[model samples]
Target chain A: MGVNGAYACVVRTKVASTNGGKPMKDTIFIKPGQMAIEDVDKPTIQAPDDVILHIVRTCVCGSDLWNYRGIDATAPHSQNPGHEAIATVDAVGSAITTLIPGDFVIAPFTHGCGHCAACRAGFEGGCLNHDDNFSMGAQAEYMRYQHAEWSLVKIPGQPSDYSEDMLKSLLALADVMATGYHAARVARVKTGDTVVVVGDGAVGLSGVLSAKMRGAKRIIAMSRHEDRAALAREFGATDVVAERGDAGVAKVMALTNGEGADAVLECVGSEQSVDTAVQCGRPGATVGRVGVPHNAKMDLRPLFFRNTQIAGGPASVTTYDKQVLLDAVLRGEINPGKVFTKSFKLDDIDAAYQAMDKREAIKSYVIVD
Target chain B: MGVNGAYACVVRTKVASTNGGKPMKDTIFIKPGQMAIEDVDKPTIQAPDDVILHIVRTCVCGSDLWNYRGIDATAPHSQNPGHEAIATVDAVGSAITTLIPGDFVIAPFTHGCGHCAACRAGFEGGCLNHDDNFSMGAQAEYMRYQHAEWSLVKIPGQPSDYSEDMLKSLLALADVMATGYHAARVARVKTGDTVVVVGDGAVGLSGVLSAKMRGAKRIIAMSRHEDRAALAREFGATDVVAERGDAGVAKVMALTNGEGADAVLECVGSEQSVDTAVQCGRPGATVGRVGVPHNAKMDLRPLFFRNTQIAGGPASVTTYDKQVLLDAVLRGEINPGKVFTKSFKLDDIDAAYQAMDKREAIKSYVIVD
Candidate 1:
């Protein structure tokens, strides 16, 4: 198998222990920028369709930075901080089907009951059965995923054939890549259209790749960071606008011959970012935003007069077929893994968060050992 | 030759007058609820593509009430207020084509140059050559229109075939009807959509008509006014929710079996109206608004999680074919003119404003003699 083979073979065992007779595991949390690794009772399978995953790889997301920066006040303090992850099934509930121990899978950012109306309609992110407090936080060493049959995507190749880089690329499909794909999709990025991706974060970089993959002729990345800009180029960004606000809009307008971009991916959720995205879009174009908005309010007058559309909310990652992106990754057509610039052991997540918080790393991956 | 034949023979003649040798005419303005009729230098055709219109029939718009209520600060004191009108083409500029003096035409609320990229692309409201200040204001005895060929839609049938009611109905097409149609079109109102129109104003009632005309199966007008509610029904609203805000949203949700509405038309630009519109929409639905928003801002968090879209700016009335609505009126398929409950001579414009401001009239007409 591969590096994860041994742990993947471990089957679920009924163990009597403290804390509701469940085994305990380590989970990380953050109170603003301060990190803490605490021992928590391992999540027990409560639903027959639940699967317990031994998280193999998890990463810090741009949204996580929102919490780290204390911008997301609603995010409970000491809340488990990760959502993007790859894991191997360690246990399956009695009613679980189509998955077994040793199977590697991609855990989506949000899980949903396969039977809920929203879930059936492909809006798992808005799942009726979802509970933010109880849902799987992939940052944990052991995580319980509900509706496993519909929530997890199986890795196509055998563990032996999966390269480290390919595995990282597949992990991105769980959140960033899927979210980026959603932004481009909702913005209705058409072939030969010029797309502007606002923000130089991993999600914005992924948007550049997604737009390119979706057949856009030109992809512009708005970035101030040299490293992220270079990475954006590597991900198929044809141009980069380092300026922000009005200057950035002026640059984009000049680039597009004053017609503005055909589509704009608003990866940053600030008022200024939203303003720039709307300002840089041509009339009748759309600005698809996936950023976790922080006190963001769009002034309707400009948006109205411009005749541009704003469409994008929390991405329904499950609505998209993860296999398409995975297939592309497996075929070596794209390298989304480049967004992960550094890696840390699960025990060293504090360093990982610090690296990301200080902008020393484009994104930090936590490898479970 | 037609009802307007008397004015047809008055050919274009340059007459030396008081203010800078321009002809003087009476126009109306308002300082909040107080109205005044003042003598001002009549607008002259300043552009080669301009036309001077003798205002024949003009009506108060729901938007005009915004200025009357002192809600629109930008509306200057003594500023001309009317935008909805049907008029006779009195004079054409040197370069004007496709229209002649005495042709009865519908003056769209906003004018476009007809040949700009935005206008050609069917977003005339965002036309590059558009000048709100220079564009015709229909409250006056005489108004100047630019890009006359594109800005004015000729009244198709002979004036002899037009009844006063039919003429008023055609005038509705200039603003209210066109705006309502634009809202429905942008929300992507399907044939069977259950649309909720939030507002009981003429525009909202017109939205009911427009939605029905666009083949909506069920339209719910959120109105507290008995007359406007009846008018809404007459315009094909299937239901009327007298409640406002959260309760109104609940009523709509209850009506939709708790699934929320398929589409919502936010005709009231207040925060409460926008809130109700967003709250009453089902996931993935759209809230199309045409209200002149006063410091309005949409909270992005709820909209994002709901996966609903908010689209609407100033309606691109030119993007739609006015002839279609005109034909509907001509054939007696619809009676939009019924919204005009009162009329006043141009000399008594104050009473027209008072009637509309006090809700004594659904809409008020100003007859220029």
Candidate 2:
């Protein structure tokens, strides 16, 4: 253990011991009886390319909820779900060059070996490495990371005095916050342009803030809850339209002089939200969507005839834009960390998830000691 | 008309009498009951900015049937319906600069003064000049055209020996053919791209040809009839999916690699065609629609998520890209005029309209002489 952070943390759940009946080695399992908390033997550095990070903070995501609910069964029980975490480098293998022990870092959501074509193209999500996929999920007490130089962003200051809000927000830099920034930037928000954001989730609220920081003349936040809408306003959403779909389009039109908004950010994954985002723009408008879709189909006629364009993809956070966004946050240009509405100790993780699932909290953060 | 080709033959149509039965007046009444063809006192040069054209060749359009059937009840029926014509200049007013007497020309479907700001922006269809508003349809004997320099393109060759096919094809540039070109171009076809042309009428068929000329790799023509499909193939459509809306999209997808087309052109004014065009594109595709939609209610969801774009307007042949298209046709690079499937004398115009309306012919032409 280091200074204020004491004791080595273990993430595995306890199991009943049988007297000499059978010897069992704990391993990650997806059986119905085995929840994500099921104990797995501590993972050691498996290769010279690996660096172990002691996760200091971990955040849950909408996608993690899908895995938990068994909706997105693409990789059933394949691995743990958490992809957003802030940590400190505990150890580096012989080959790891840039990162040393005790360096605080925001781990990339996806890990790349940094030598492949995709990594060269800055798309770590599509990294071609066949041997190293563990650098992605940063949820455990000790997470092994490959390609340490590219996978880690060293927090410039020590963690002892860091504000909980600022530290919790760095979890967003792992994925959600950066994803929203990518969406807004890709939509080409210009000065004096009207921007509409669909979804009032953490990513959406972040987009509202991002659009404002991008100099949008007006930012309209589409939300259902009073609290989220109020947060959106506090984050610089100039208008809020609570309607959905066609009615939402009409509301946007009414506000935009019968012409729709100039840009739209679709941060929700639902089909209805997607449609509303496109319809809430004027001719020659653009919509940037970052929500990972499940089974959404598309129509081209409206987009073509109205001269609207859509641009979106997975958020490549550390791909040349991390410093830009980091500088903005450091200078207080955006306060994306404000989305963390609830906090819990590492011991009460289940309660944090329960609070979030009940819609009682926009986001939850678990701090490690 | 001097030397047949030298003097621009034109035609003019005017109300024979006013609603008040005033004796010979400058302004006349235009009512459905008063649509009798009458010899009005011939038009004299009205302004220094005018050019009197002798109507040499004129043809009817499918939209003309709408007026004759009283479907467009507010369109002022007593006014002529013909907009496609080729003519020769008989006289030029003092302010007429580029156009002179004895020049044969093609008067585009729209009549624009061409000097207004809107016209300057290549939106002659929305010209602001008073006389540019349907001053006279091309079905008459002589036409006094304002803004002659901007509204007319000098005929490339003599009209006397012109084949009926060539003349009919040339006449197409005045409207539908150009509209099809606009639709296809807006759809943004490129090499190795699959395109779906919705609508099998003249404009749609011409769109098939336009897509082919624009290097579309696989042209899927959606038509209801075998004859139109055959014509579409002749015009270079690689495939013909004789279905509508969703089914048509399935057929296109089946032909493509389970992905929809890269481009879709909606040429029919029906909501069905609009939806079908939208459904027939892959993610990040475009659909171009040029039809004047009779009624269109669209869903905007697929556009935002799938990254589809849409753009279109009336065929601004008088002010946009028509010269480039005309040059291509004159060089036989593409022959969209083949859509005219039947012809009739002006006296048999009723039969011509019936033929097209009943689907007995793809398109009908009227020989004014």
Candidate 3:
């Protein structure tokens, strides 16, 4: 299913629901470039660790556009596709102990077993004991949350306890916020550094905020879109570059006194974008590449000669959300939900995807309660 | 003129000699697969920073094999090719103040102004105030060294002050020793880490020593050569895997309990070698790639998805040399010179190149005095 190509790992192991399946409205990928909200069999305990989530808040992600834009191919004609959600725990499997019915929680995009090597090392995104597709079908009335004991992060209270804006911010912790923070962390963004954030997309804007939080002295954002550029500035970008490729590199170099950036976050994974990201780093800079690499290859010799290091991958949603982002959001220290520029009802999920695909919205917030 | 392909950055700034060109025994690259020590015009002061060195000892580097193996094209058929040297400061330039005549010094491969942004940041390899190159023609009776004030590392006394073994040890500091340390530095090899050294040459063997010196808990040297593998063990390798490609990856994985290495040093710049090095790193691991990449391209998507960071370039000879490597050598803490398995007189330089090209010697030491 198109939970977006980046998070579209499918599960082959299917467990029969212990009860007769009830009907519910859930999002599904009908085919490339098309999404549908239809009546489907409501999720139930698929495993001992599974917990049924009554989705309170769900949204369309930037990655969803990859599938809606007809980029990735999948074998199934339709698969329940969604990952981000703020939800109420409706049912808990017997083995699940950390989560129970009526608990207010945010379901991270990735579910990691707490005991895995990657999880213990704080890289839950690469969890070796992962179900690979455990958290899909999240944009619905009810979705089965796997690894509930560890993957579901409990907020203080029910969704009504927070304002609409706060809920949006909490929803962001499910994916993009952590993803952006991952980029900065992997690039080793430290205090007093000059950071270059490529792509003015939601993640890129989030990266601007993350870099700022990491104590970067100056942040240069590469973006051509005016709205995104303005948002980048709001997110703490010191400079915005509209031109791309060599021209973009020239602008960053000029701004950095021909030395380039101390840390570069490559938030757009195209060849041109990645090339610009690498070229804009200083002699000993590290570039954080978090955008789903479409068909980009790093020119190794150039990176080698320039002494640039590149580090990144899928975001450790569980790791970051549990470790810091949740508390930061709760304390109103960050507003990642500002990226959700538009809104749509759960039935209008297709339009949300279209808005993002057409570049009309940085991200689309879905009202799924 | 054949110092090797990697050091063949041709300098176009021709300097006129005040004295009628005096003849000295020097190496010149005649063609691919050939090297010669001929009576050629000795180097003279070309810049204010230039100082003439009475070459006491020099050697062939792994990079030189690039030219000797018929790689990298150049407009000029003959250019002085050498970067590593231990010599006596025969003459000081007018502007040079940091060093004086009769002082024994190690000439680092890359000469930096010591005040450029890159140099100031301890990455002299990417020094902005570089002369493109300033330390070529080092394997000669007498050579002109540029950036004399900061590039020359002074030993305590004249050449006679050190034993033959100590002199060889000091000479290794000019390139290989520091280069090996560079891989570890860039990869962030830390205490209790499992490091993978991918290459069986002098630099790779030196990487084993550097990884050990960095407090790596386990050092895995990927070597097929019996002699080089033994040297790798002597240099602090805990494991030696003679397999290559997929087989090599399996071997390393098995040794690390299928977790792969914490740090990987890509000392061999070929595509196959690089791929092997990358696969041997655990999730979220960093690979230090110091080999001169010859027609090698890093598959960035794989690197990004696996959360691997690739960091490295030309070794920061000045930074590591001035900071720690030289002191380590002088203290008799490391024996990097042991990689020099064979020695040749200045007149037998051709045989030295032949031996290295055929893998008969890990490195060839040249006694030019």
Candidate 4:
């Protein structure tokens, strides 16, 4: 019995660049409101640490609109545009030890190899990769993943029993949902802490859910759109302010007994959003912003004199904390996936972008059916 | 003797309301480089916690220039325009306990009662006050300081042979020197950490001294002028970058093995200064900005992805760490007071402002004599 306990683990079959169906050749890219589906070569395990994932389902993101309009200059050139995906491992490299073919996994929008200092310190999104700049984006048929162990979350079993809505919501654990949580976490929302969320888009809505999970006593969602405000309420917003600037600040103060919210999360990255976030905070409060601003200008005097602290960085979704958040969702503590209100077929990707751009949907997911 | 330690100690003096010379009946305000010296009543303490300081040496600041040009709307309606001053305790109220008449002291720009939560937490600059917005500024002939014990730093007893230069230099501790130290500390300049300091003004020059005291391995001073840059080098700047933007970042990178500096101090609050400070930082580096930014448009994507943290506030000079910094100055570990390059009589105050505005002097002190 002791000898059997020390037996070597059997190796699984590798999907070596060879054992595949006439390798699927399709990739998606977005350009200024239009989606392009073009034929492309299938990706292979390029590095020892990389694993090939056959994308099972992928989704549209609010951030995609920036690249759809060519605003995010640093955005990847043309390979793939999606970051959230549920996938099945199709291949493993010889150097890979933790993953095997046939494992069901969720891929984070941004992946970092597990060994960099940043990754070790739990800031995986800022990993120091010696071989690649853009590691793994999920909008393609087959994606090459770096740091397979850290980047992929193993689903205990096939999630066939889960509804598409449930799966799509879980997809947010890859980025948007995590981004919202990161914003709330950085803002240090505590029990009885008044929170003001700027922006009613997907991340902002998700932020309402996040603040609620963090035990925020009152969450004030600042939005002009009726639909978004309603969605914010559904997601646990205790109050909603439709006004902007001094009027909005007045409304927030009125709701908080003349003291502003203890924390403000700027989910939209605009000059207006930043200014709004700053003005909504009480003295010595913090404002955590995740909006990747196209052209951002922050006046430091208001922030300094009001004793405001601004802290938010790219969400480290692939870090160790992702598992904790995933468990939170499974435990019914939060349903971040509620932000997705629309779904579409992968072949009809163009409609997904159009619907999001026209504000017809808050968030859209594309099923690879 | 044992009971005496537990009992409330008492010290009393009947201080006159005036300095015995015409009551100094002039208050000055500036508008777009224009000075309006108007006759106003000499300021007196109105709150029980307030103590009056007889201004002996007050100096002009780069921040005051913003008020002169009307860029800071929050600037007092009739700006007295000085925040750094050495004064003698002129009067005190019954509620005031620590400060007494005849004590020579340096009054910080803003005052905080030591009992507030913010003061207890060492961020006295964020004190929640019911009486006034900011404690009375240290300009004019007399200042009404709130929270006397917590707001004033008594000067060490003169060795009976202390020189006038030594005293004025000590006065620099009231603001610039302390602020510079605060910025360096917030940036967390470690031993062997490469630090890049933007701006060559009094605060920037003082930052160099502060960095030296913190044991920074390399100090890069960013300045455009030759004289200021030379002064920075003299004050312990190991390298100087005269360029701005990508070129400046490249120079700093080249100096630091292409990784960039570990810490950057942004002493100027403009958008360009903030960006430059962000640009000079390496991954996991920090940027501490103390400038009252006019318009600071910081990009969140880069800041987040690079894992750089930005932290700063109005220097809580008289708070927890002021004494620690002051002791260094007294011990000769730092001589930041050398920054006082010009001095003026109270009648030559206009010339003092002109000199600072024109950048003809780093710092100009107005002596009561």
**Against the true structure, what is each candidate's TM-score?**
0.87, 0.58, 0.94, 0.74
Share of real interface contacts recovered by each model?
0.58, 0.09, 0.64, 0.40
Residue-wise lDDT of candidate 3 within A275-319, one digit each (tens)?
888889878889998888886455677777778888988777878
What are the per-residue Cα lDDT tens digits for candidate 2 across B249-351? Answer: 8888788766577788988767777778877876545777776655544555445434455666555576443547777767777676677778766555556
Clashes of each: 1, 30, 5, 4
The order of the candidates by DockQ, greatest first, is: 3, 1, 4, 2
lDDT tens digits by residue: candidate 4, B65-142:
765555542323354546677888889978877878878787776577666545654556666654342433455677
Candidate 2 deviant stretches above 4 angstroms? A1-369, B1-37, B41-52, B75-77, B91-95, B111-136, B144-148, B319-323
Q: Which candidate leads the pack in TM-score?
A: 3
> What is the C-alpha RMSD, rounded to one decimal, of candidate 1?
6.5
Clashing pairs in 4: A32-A68, A169-A337, A297-B297, A298-B296
Query: When only chain A is evaluated, what TM-score does every model earn?
Result: 0.89, 0.85, 0.94, 0.87
The worst-scoring run of ten residues by lDDT in candidate 1 chain A lies at: A1-10
Per-residue CA lDDT of model 1 for B1-369, tens digit only, reads: 000100111112234465476554454454667666666667777888888888888877766666567654223445455677788888999998878998888888667677765666556777765545123357778887777777788887545567878877887877787778778877879888889999888788878998998889989999999999999988999999999878888888789877677788988777888888988887667888887665566677778776677777666665464546777877899888888889888888778888988899988988885
CAPRI class of candidate 3:
medium
Candidate 1, after superposition: displacement of residue A352 in Å? 2.5
Q: After superposition, how far is residue B74 of candidate 3 from its true place, in Å?
A: 5.3
Residue A25's lDDT within candidate 1 is 44
TM-score of chain A of 3: 0.94
The lowest-lDDT stretch of 10 consecutive residues in candidate 3 chain A is A9-18
Categorize the docking of model 1. Answer: acceptable
Q: Better model by lDDT, 2 or 3?
A: 3
Question: lDDT of model 4 at residue B267?
Answer: 88
